[model samples]
Target chain A: MSEKLATAPRGKVSLFGVLRSESIRFFSLNSTRILILLAIVLYAAIAAIGTWGIGSLRASMGGMEQMPGMEDLAAPGFASELMGSGLVFSQLILGVLGVLLFSGEFTTGSAVSTFLASPQRLRVLAAKTILITVVTAGVQIVSSLLAFAISKPIADNYQMDLDFGSDAFQRVLWYGALAVAMAALIGLALGMMLRNSAGGITSLAALFFVLPIILSILTSITDWAQHIAKFTPDQLGMALATPSSVVTDLESWQQLLGVAGWIVLPLALGAVLLAKRDIK
Target chain B: MIQAQQLTKKYGGKTVVDNASFTVQQGMVTGFLGPNGAGKSTTMRMIVGLAAPTSGEVLVNGRDFKKSRHPLTEVGTLLEAKSVHKSLTPLAHLRAMAATAGLPVSRVHEVLEVTGLSSVQRKKVGGFSLGMGQRLGIATALLGDPQVLILDEPVNGLDPEGVAWVRNLARQQAAEGKTVFISSHLMSEMAQTADHLIVIGRGRIMADAPISEFIDNGLDQTIVRSADIEVLMNALNGDGVQLRRIDEHGVEVTGPDSVTIGRRALEYGVVLSELRPLQRTLEDAYMELTRDAVEYHSSNVAETGGGK
Candidate 1:
């Protein structure tokens, strides 16, 4: 028994060890795997469906040629460009997954075990943040590539030009991943703040779904509200991922700044709270 | 060993654990006996650094647990049963915890076997019974094979077998010169398991001594029975001996052992019907110590106030 005990290493809880433990626990759950798979499948499926529908519409409008902006809409192989069409839905799904990662710990009373293993509370939080960000980013990228592959032939059938190397496509890939990452971080923050699954997810939904709709309505009535709506996470993520042909007054840098702000503010607040509050 | 120096915890303006101090030495199973709301859990949490003390400090192995780098190897705590994710199997949870201390995965299986959780190692903890959950909790605590073990209500939901297993485990761990600090509201269980007893009541230390000392501190009493009970009562009457009539045939006497009572009765030529020494149990000692310290006084108004 003493020799068996001698094999157990003592002292100094390393961040790397904590991160590994957190990652294993995060992935071992069925819910986490299901959420990631659902996000990926939904992202790819929505992209393929959107491509087929848009391809048909473009073909039909080509013969008429009377609709305003018809020529602008007739980009060759627009179907391929639709590969990232489901970025919003993907972000929402993975965002909820992110919320559950931390919030579930508290809801199920696992936070005690987690913190006890690594008493440096911030190290555990950091481990969780890195694990979720990496996993979410990986899922988003894989879904985008799969959607592109499936949508390419359909775009070719409609004679739409789909250039993977184009600046717009690259922006869609990079900014799209960033958008999902931001949503996940925000979800992680909300999880730490609320520390309840239903409460955190509900609050996340209100931020992404209800708040944007209310802001859109308010923007229509008041000119000043438009600026506020532009800064919303949903709007920043959408503008960054899918640049519309219709130009707006804000520069590309300003839209990127909006995305950066959305990611930074909430995450900073959440980190502070995570460090300060007692693990329940 | 665990040492707490003037440990205090305040929630808002209410002081849950006052400036209390005690030391738990190694090589002994120290029982933390306290009534509910006596701050036993809070003090334990503070010692493990889960709850920060408002002032003062608790040191495990001569240093604060918060400052210790390898806490799991220093102190193993089973704060509560099922403090794990329901979705995770006991194997995954234990493996993850072991990974933190750089312990091999084999330790996980070893602890599972020891705790009798090998059969349910793959089952989700959400579906586990209370006894199984307690076993899992103990397994996780033993994963690090730490020197000090702190368990709170470890046998709350165990069957007779589990209770016996825990008793043997505690004694075995202490026999190995490891510190075993266990808290339980069950006096009978503590009486059987603990070598040294620390009794807490209403957020204050009531008695901190050996189990034998605790039993000895309470008053000694003897029960006597006689057909001529009135005569025996009269014979036993003295400045030192006090007697209470339990019924028509029996008298409960305090301040005199049964030998003294029997000798007195025999000298008086009174026929001895029954003379027995009534040994005070640990429960009696605990109740006598904590009777005034019970925090929540539920009114028995429904029973006592009803009209006969």
Candidate 2:
């Protein structure tokens, strides 16, 4: 039993304070550390193996100089780019990390603590959004850089040019990181909306994995399916990362709008549900 | 002080709490007594703005809680047990909550110690026993040293010692002039801890008065046996008085104190063999109030009633 005291000063909730709290909770978990480690290790390992396999193939094809388009296949720094071949897996892993960031609150009944501490529920949502975005972006960038540094020499051994400053290379680095951020944001939104780990993760997998394959098959049958497929987050993110390979039908502004829709719609819906529903 | 006016909450066509209204005063532990599903938790949630009232409003310190900027400092609540993350230790959870109000981390440790959670402060809440979880919940409620304290089922999982501890804590808080509001199903606990009682049944207030007044307002009966039972029964009848014959030499008198019955019997020249006033426990009072309101009333009510 404690005595009643004078009312405490209720200052406006600063985003920085909320972010700090999110960071503390995020780093406190063993799962977060494990996910980040797995993302980096898996990315580097996939890159190394792809580089070795591609290098051996090029060596074997060296004597067939007359093969049309074979030289393009041996393009310089291909092996270096191969090092980041596991970006898709990285996205999935880190995206789930984002999903767990919010879903775990509900699953573990910690949303009560979170919302009670900052009753402006949307502020907590915004804070978590910012945290997942920054952390996912940071991890993606660092994982890509590590993979590139390790695979550069392997590409050079095969006499491939590995320029770090090329526009294509930078696109793969920066936009690839952005793609990871997008995936994480989408995952976070789904997590908040679903508020269950399996439901959120399954929905994310369907969006990124199953739906894209289904759309690819659908495109073979109809023109309208191709138009819809071009706007999917999977296509948009892939086009944004590998500019030379995945040519998107969307203009720059259209792609930006698609990304915005992907991020904003689910998050807005999740926030509304969170504000309206009971914490239990 | 906490004032709830016409507070109502409806979920999908069912009204959980129906226009409940009551004012809880300071310097006393007011017990919120209700049968299961009587909307005690809903009322507590509405007070803190956790669950919105469909109609009406609840005010803390003369203002709506939602509009109050300094809510945590104004009112501390333990709404439910284990409303914490499983992965988070009590230390991290409390520190995070304390940081919201810019309160010192030192206060977190202080509350942990106060709630007897110092030993388990570093343990993850997932590993905590129910009693430990309750302690952590209480520690969180006490973090802000609030003017108004609202606890729903504070002693639900406590052992006997923990129960006594909660009783002391409630009394000590009230002695310091804070408005302490606690809800529980345990009538004996409420009887020992609450100075004022507000009994609710079926989302409505059944009785609101001092603990003693609730006990005294209902009924008082005494059983008397004498060689001249017929004489005793005649002597005890008047305004606000009634009598019922028990057997050959026994009678039960209602609406008269034991002293008055004994004095009357002596004045009427009846030698009483046995005279005793049946004490009414708080459990009896609660049962009388919630007899119709209990969701599952036992068939033995008649048998229990006859014995009492």
Candidate 3:
């Protein structure tokens, strides 16, 4: 019996090992695969639809910018911006993925096995952070690339400029990934702090969608509302990813800082709470 | 080995585990016996660093488990059944856990085979029965082959065969010089499995001793039945011995073994019909020890039934 004990070589816990563990479980779930595929397919489909809509509109209004408030859609670079038309949905969808990644541990009581295997609470957090970051960012990048591939031919049919080398399209491809990754990280943090899937995803939705409308209403009434509204996660993500669609005069660095704040603050607070509170 | 020094835990204003202090030595099966809501689970959680101590400390193998370099190899724990995600199959769950500690994939299969879960390794845990979930939990605990094993209510949902298997597993692990700590509310189960018993009640350590000492702590009670009961009572009555008439021809003698009483009856020329000594069962002793410490007291059904 003694010899049968530990027939395999015993190994220690490491950051890389935990990362591997996180990825193994992450990919094994049906929900994760559904969300990733949904994010990519939905993003590309929306982008193609947007491109066709803009192309037909431009063709119908031949030789003249006759429509008021439609000038942005008629612009040459708008086709590139069309590729990122599904950025908001990507954020929410992948954001829910992030929320489930951490919240599932608590909801299913798997945190017991996870932490027992690697007792340092912060290490588990780090591994989860790394996993969500790579997966969400990678998914967003792929989605953006697929959206571009699907939208480019539609733009060419309308003779619109859909240059892959264009600065606006580049921003949509790269910063768009950053924006989705930010939303996903925030979702991960909310999941850790709330420890409930419904509450975390609802809070994430309220942050990304509902809060902006409420803040817009408040901005009409007060000067301070304008300041806070611009820093909302949804607006910051849009302003960084597709600057042509939103009107914002803030410096690029300030918007990046805002994005950084969204990513870092909640996760840091979650780490502190995770270390201080018991795994109940 | 695990050493808990003045370990205490409180939730809100209610104290859960209050001032528990004990040591679980290697090469023995230590039974943490307590009634429901007696802080047995909380203490086990604390031992593995799942729950932080409110004021005191618990050391696993001479240091905090949180700081251990190889956590899986240091302490493998089963906090409760069904701790794995429902959507995950046992194979995926075990693989994920093994990946965390860099253990070989073969170890996962070994545990699955050991726990008789090979047949359903690919099935989602959500579809597993309670007993199967328990087996998976045990399999997870044994995955790391840790020096210390902490199982909380390991036999809660097991069949009789599984229960005996767990008993043998605990004994074999202890025999192999590994520290085995198991928590159960059943004294009868512990009587058959544990060499050392640590009884807890209402978050307090009630008794910690060898299994033999726990059973032998009570005074001897012997039943003596005779045709000449009055003669036996008068002759057997002495200091430190109390006699009670149980029936028309029987007297219960306390503080003397049946052998002593039989000799005394012979000396007094008493014709005895019965000279039986009642054995103190672990269940009775446990009930006696935790009479005041039980969290919930059930009302007498006879009294309650009258109202119904």
Candidate 4:
């Protein structure tokens, strides 16, 4: 019985091995595949319906509205931007996928197996980070492309040009993926920090869904509330992905810096906590 | 070989494993014996780097095990719980663990078969019985074919057959010159499985020695009831012998086997009404060793049947 395995030379735990292990476990779960499918289908369906509804409205009215606070709704980029109408919801679902990636390890007591195999706590964190980043970025990119493909014909029915080469359109396509990716990384960080699935996902929603509303309410009474609102994850995602959605004075570098801050800070903090705490 | 040098662990001013130092020799089964909350689990966790030591270190094969270059090959540890995501099947879980150390899929199958988990390898662990989960945990520990195996409370929820299977497996592994260190609160289980014993209590090492020596240190006691108790007591008195008189007619004699006591009584021509030797079980020795080290000792029952 021992001779069969005794002769096989063993290897030290490598980064590729860790990554492959994470991928295999990640893909085999029913929840992960279901969430990914939900994100893609939800994003595409919302974009298609948004394009059809908006085109029908424009056709019946024979023109677009010209009123106060209607400028964003009537912008030239709005046709291409229709593809990203459901991005916030998609980011929420994909962020949930991200949260589950790390949180599942603790909630199910599998972190013991994972850490005992590698022993270096930081390496496990590194592997999860890479896995979450790669898979979420890949998922977001596909979701965006699927939404765009489904929305294009509807945009053409209204004689509105949703050109792929337009700067605004290209920004919507690429930066929308970036927005979803950032949300996912933040969710991953929260999962590691909180180490509980329901708490992590709820906190994620509170940040993206609830905090944005709270900040908007705060903006009505205080001048500085708007300043803080501009930096919230939702604002950063929307402001970057759909550049014409909200008026802002910050340059592109500052926007990128804000996005980088949202991604790096929580993950860095989570890594430190993970290294110090017991696996249980 | 596994060595812990003054290993200490403190959780918020409460020490869990207090200055424990012991060596688990290769090619033998070393049983970690202790009562509940005696730091047996904590010490095992520290050995595998799952729980950090507040001071000192643990070395596996004469090297620091925390930053081991080849952890899977050096030591395979099943610290506590199922140690697996419940949603995953045993096959997928083992396959993933094997991938971490670059072991072959055939090796995964081998461990599954070794642990008798191949029949239910594809079933989700969430619905697994506790015994099946334990089998999977054992299979995981054997995935890398590690030199050192650490299993904590392996027989907690197993049938008699499963229990005997684990006993045989530990013996088989040790016979093959591998280190098999298992922790259990069951003294009878440890007595049957371990060649060496490291008894711990209240986060401290109560005793560390060979199993035979541990049991022998307690000695056998014989209850001798005789009408001529004074003459028997005088004959049994010696440098190592201890005698305790219970009533006017009974005396407990220790430090010598019962056969010697009976022969001395025969030679002295003392009439014996009763002569019964109390064989010292490992359970008795363990209780004697950790009598003061028990962290939680219940008082006498205040009522029967919950005062119903």
RMSD of each: 3.2, 3.6, 1.8, 2.5
Tell me how far the alpha carbon of residue A276 in candidate 3 is from the true structure, in angstroms, after superposition: 0.7
Model 3, range B124-164, lDDT digits (tens) per residue? 99999889999999999999888999999999889998999
Give the better candidate number (1 or 2) by TM-score.
2
User: Pick by TM-score: which candidate is best?
Assistant: 3
Residue-by-residue lDDT tens digits, candidate 2, B221-308: 8999998898777777789887888899988788888999889988999998999888888898898899888765556767778664
- DockQ for each candidate? 0.46, 0.42, 0.64, 0.60
Pairs clashing within candidate 2: none
Highest lDDT: which candidate? Answer: 3
Candidate 1 Cα misplacement greater than 4 A, ranges: A1-7, A63-66, A75-80, A245-249, B225-239, B243-252, B261-271, B298-308
Rank ordering of all candidates by lDDT, starting from the highest: 3, 4, 1, 2
DockQ of 4: 0.60
Report the lDDT of model 1 for residue A76.
40
In angstroms, the error of model 1 at A229 is 2.0
* Model 4 C-alpha lDDT per residue in residues A1-280, reported as the tens digit of each score: 1223443457679888888899889998999999999999998898889888888887887656565655565677887877777778878998999899999999999999999888888888888888887887788778878887888888898887677778777777788888888889999999999999999999999999899899899999999998888888878777887777655777889889999999999999999999899888
Worst 10 residues of 2 chain A by lDDT: A1-10
Candidate 2 residue B158 C-alpha distance from true site, Å:
0.8
